[model samples]
Target: MFSKIVIACALVALCQAGFLHYHEAPIHYSAPDHFTPSQSYEAPAIHDEPAHEDHYVDEYAYPKYGYSYSVEDPHTGDHKSQHEERDGDVVKGEYSFLQPDGSFRKVTYTADHHSGFNAVVHNSPPVIHNH
Candidate 1:
């Protein structure tokens, strides 16, 4: 009628200045509270750790041991030595070497189970290098 009343007064002044609102202007946030888990809350009981007993020691995993070694050399005038011992069924020892024309030998031995073995050898001569 008059441009339909001027388009209804410009849509009522654009809905009173809210410009026909497409929503975005009502924020009042605070966020720092959220642990919601309640139905009269109740949960704290876990026990089962108290039962230990195990021990067995017999004290004899080889009871005894012995060892010895030696060697001497002045440019091929070789010499040697050995020693031994044991604490079960008895066993004693001695040894020596060097014999390739440069003679030298030694041996002293023993055994147990009622002296079932024995040895005693000694020979030494031929190591004269008056150089």
Candidate 2:
């Protein structure tokens, strides 16, 4: 029992000695944040592709059956013009328009029974502006 008491006292002394040797890390206070209000942004100018509409269809095989090309899309072709023409059973056209997210969507399509309706769409990422 006496040995147990001495052991307990020695353990406490050892703990205190270890505690005295330990040192706390230095503390530093950060500077307060300062932010400036953002400025209003202006819109960028849109450069839409011009129309290349043909007055009449030109075809060696069938001039009368030849189709003149042009399509005004309701969704994205507000001020944009598309190219389209019917070469007998086959039809082809291309058009481009701006997106709401400042991206560009261009589509080239062809339709026929042999190849079916095929559309090749090209998408461009939006450009960021700093104001």
Pick by lDDT: which candidate is best? 1
Give candidate 1 regions above 4 Å deviation: 1-63, 75-78, 97-102, 122-131
In model 1, the Cα lDDT at residue 22 comes to 84
**Colliding residue pairs in candidate 1:** none
Worst 10 residues of 1 by lDDT: 57-66
Error of 1 at 19 (Å): 99
TM per candidate comes to 0.34, 0.41
Residue-level lDDT for 124 in candidate 2: 92
- Candidate 1 lDDT, 1-131, residue by residue in tens: 99999999999988888535587889898988889787796678988988887878887666357899988987976778899897787888989888887777889998889977798999978767776
RMSD of candidates 1 onward, in order: 25.9, 25.3
- The lDDT per prediction is 0.84, 0.77
**Top-TM-score candidate index:** 2
TM-score of 1: 0.34
